[model samples]
Target chain A: MNRMSSENNLDKPKEDEIVRIDFAFRKELAEKVEGNLASFCYQCGACVGDCPATFYSDDFNPREIMLKVLYGLEKELIGEDSVLWLCTNCYNCTERCPQDVKPVEVIISLKNMLADRGIVPKTVSRIIDTFEKTGRTVQLSSAVTKERAKLGLKPLEEIPMDEIHKLLAPAEEDSGK
Target chain B: MNKFAFFPGCMIPARYPHMEYAIRKTLPNLGIELEDLPEASCCPDPIYFKSKDKLSWLSIAARNLCLAEDKGLDIVTNCSGCTATLSEARHLLEDEELRTKVNKRLARIDREYKGEVRVRHIVTVVRDVAGYEAVKESVKCKLEGLKVAIHYGCHLLKPSKIMNVDDPNDPKVMEALITALGATPVRHRNWFLCCGKACQDEDIPANMMRDILSTVRDVEADILCLICPTCFSQFDHGQVRVGKRFGEDFNTPPVYYFQLLALAQGIQYENLGFNRQRIKPKILDKIETTLSHA
Candidate 1:
């Protein structure tokens, strides 16, 4: 059986197809994720079997993401319209990966990289802004308070925004202070 | 009675306060005392917040932990997202370097992650700490003959090294809890499938939820019982949307495990806010009828 002649021979690249490894991007991801778990993935499709996103979407696959990570394909993963957000962060991939790749963490690091570049989705940005402002993602409206009171639950306490603001300060601001 | 710092997270308190009401009413009866954690922020949401800034997420989660630590009590979280964030943060901060890094940020708020307390999901607190026997004994109205389909969701039991609540693949915690309430926990197809609430794409979560709902329907379960509020929102409110999208009637009512416990422990059905739910649990009617006949 000549494996290269088979119809499923996409693994065997043509003479013109070349994957450029962006080592710098890989280093950046490594700095974000401790031990660089992405490097451990051996292309086992275990992560895909249980992935809800992969089951529904043609574009999203954790194994493929890991392969791209190995090749240091940062541009493909961290853009505004990247497929990374399709991930539910379920950690099923982390559970099923035989090599302990923790593909979800790798994808999250990629997401963090995308976020660092200010390419956040509007919904996620709203949550971030809300958290920064109120020290909670969902605002406590008067209606919410009324409902709690009806349930005999205690009234909502205000989070210390000043303390949260200090923690949310940018690196430059912290250093400058 | 064991005392815990109750970390309700955002969704339960802000969106599904009834779940909070049920927990407050039930846990005290089951030998667990709830002390509210003052000034605790969002577990900052484990997904989007972490995606934006890992350090800030870790710091915010640690700050929430500090609220419990100051009270010298372990934390019990109702939402799976909060448990995952706090547990994973505790697991990561075990590394001296990361702890120091997080502490550097925490020092800004006059706090530190001394790793003094443990973060536990409310389900684990009910099962492991309070024991299933206590649950059975506390039941004034057993959910007898009710078939419950269990949804463990994702964060409550996954990334085994960190969450460590149960076997992510073959978890029996939720089922055991359900059975203790005098209901039969039906093992439905796609039992291990995530509720897909966290998936951003409409089609992905819709399909994922449709798969789970279809299985729950096949099992003929009276209600889909779950621990996470996010899953509750999906199967209860989101089910209407998913059913409409897929053109199927997924009328399965979703009930939080604590709500079931509150009901079984003799909390009035009306007081628990079932009326506010999108898809009302028909089993509650049956229970009410049975109680009246008795």
Candidate 2:
């Protein structure tokens, strides 16, 4: 539980074992964003019990993700493992955690950090840009428009790109901070 | 009850326009009118957008809610995902610092989050606002013993603190709506599982969906009563793809609860697009049987 000073370096650590500790990021996440709940996680495996996605992959434990945050294993989590995408954001884990460790909220902060570094999955990266372009994850085509006509519904309108760009500018700046 | 805006989100209008048609055609008969939610974006897509940028996700969802606030109408979203996102946004913005941060961003567009309006999923509007009995009375015919397994997709009932949409585990909203249609809402094992709508990797969601669909099979459900468009597609279409991939038979049909409501309220069978469904839903035949019985 002791904070090792030599473990702070980014790449291949000064230690023989890669401890994967980025205490600064951990502090920022715990204090500024998802709260100190990540630090409070005792890894009781309650999150694994609550995760419906666990059936598909054993590695997709919300508790493990919290452990990553606690250990500041950003590379092991966000870089090596694609477990973040596997989280359905179902909230069952966060909702049921006894320590009030909201793994889903903490997971998002992890995703935001990964996204800030442009290290997210291609599809996730694409959709984030897609929303900026069209204000929709999927765009409306003429065929769908005609189908809308058949359904007696009007064409679905999107928020203008300029407005979306303007709205995101401040956050993009803040994410930099 | 008669006037409110609709938040179709992305999925329904994109892949399932007919669901909106069904709701539009049905809700009015139940005394609810849906107006278009002007200049709305993805709810900005709950899982994906929120994951990428939490602050912007909240700001954007709050902005979407502001449109409804300006119109002085509670927003009713068609997709559970949108309902979850908007609801979470509404809850998060209650914090003064978060509201200040989001409002500062919104100010450029001459929009601000006053949090005056509410966001209700269409199911809540039906069961809570329209009242279950009002809907039940509107059903002049029974579904002729068609048994439905209710799938309350994750967003509608999770992070229950932020999303007061339903009780997470003991949700009776969808079942109550299903019972009103004269179909038996079959309770099954894993009734509280997700359809993995947020799992982007097809394999994980496919396998997860297979488990839920298998439960539907185990209970011998005639069809799934689905509210979320993502869940609807996953059950109806994703089942086929996943089943094919896994070499398992996930043949359970998914019917949007709205379609059943519209059908029970006497919308013609051919008009609602049962043919488009992979499992070929027969809510119409059940209706036909009930009409003959009557």
Candidate 3:
């Protein structure tokens, strides 16, 4: 449990832990990402035009996320209300971006940054919990197994459940640690 | 002989042993050697990406890569998530500042990567290293007339530049390998669609299953060829639940890309973990029939 406590402490920003915003952080982060030619973006809305997710839902706007990053709106860009989660990571926006701004990569970078800060949504946490419990993220409940048999499908042989439990025992212990 | 540092992500050893059996049996015939990396940890998928801890994720992945580099062989992965994460980390480590930051955190583990090794997905190795002609020559049994729908899972091709094996939208290498196995590659619209595995948490599994079932039905193919373990598990296992949810009978064919290759090489179904799958299509009999006729 000491390790978990330490991890929790590390995630919490101290009074002086604020990263001084400079052009260098943005430049370095941008350079580390692939296919993001942010300098080429001239605010042409070609990316907005091709984003299917954006048109269907205001929750996912690649154009706005890109604009925020380019304008150095670090707080607003990485804020909790940002719609970065809605991205399907489909690369559709990257393909259609006329200026090669690569909103897809930028959004991924933002997500990665947030994850570092330990702000992952509860839904994602459950999945990781299941993955940690069972080696597989998607576990078929017993009812689902019966339904499978009703359809004339064979029941999936459990992969040595006890053995798998042992294999995954370490991850659970480590997570707790 | 091409010797590769093997990275079998968690799923292959525990759930999908068929993929492991196929790779173990086939790679040797192709003159590719897979050296076991025993201490290799979980690719820490779904969590690493969802957690978005760049330092921890990169550091952990770099530790795995550094293990391979220590062996002085190129790192090869059968899992798409492992390939994507490792490749992304490899690219990030190329920057001196990023490497220093990542390595400093990883200093606890006493691991640092010098960016000397290459991370290759099994599909990339088969297409690039083995070549179509070599695959054709190794086929003891050809899968003639077996219709297959190739599903290049999202992680393999997305952020297309890092994994620039082929065009993400119009990938053909998997199809070419299927063709070399003497099978017919079926084209479908949802070929480019995400298995929705990435968003399985957001949507109900039943909804995601329905989406997957609809995609399989739309293709109307005999079997769906998958290059990823996550997609394989989703399509093969998820289809059953999806059918029950929709109150419709949908028995879509699902097989790994290497499983098809192993079958083409005459590996038996039981050994390839076929019996462990939820859905066992009549297509296995068809494959036997086709092989006997040849």
Winner by DockQ? 1
DockQ, all candidates in order: 0.63, 0.57, 0.11
lDDT of 2: 0.80
Candidate with best TM-score: 1
TM-score per candidate, chains pooled: 0.94, 0.91, 0.75
TM-score-based ranking: 1, 2, 3
> Judged by DockQ relative to the true structure, which candidate is superior, 1 or 3?
1
- Kept native contacts, as fractions per model, are 0.81, 0.74, 0.14
Residue by residue across A133-159, what tens digits does model 1's lDDT show?
887778787877898988788888888
lDDT for each residue of candidate 2 in B175-199, tens digit (9 for 90 to 100): 8888888889998786788888677
Docking class of 3: incorrect
After TM-score superposition, the amount by which residue B168's alpha carbon in candidate 2 deviates from its true location, in angstroms, is 1.5
Worst-scoring 10-residue span by lDDT in model 2 chain B: B283-292
- What is the TM-score (0 to 1) of candidate 2? 0.91
Model 2 regions more than 4 Å off: A1-21, A28-36, A171-177, B283-294
**CA displacement after TM-score superposition, residue B24 of candidate 3 (Å):** 0.9
Candidate 3: tens digits of C-alpha lDDT, residues A95-142 = 677665767667767776665466667777676666455544456566
After the best TM-score superposition of candidate 1, give how far the Cα of residue A37 lies from its true spot, in angstroms.
2.0
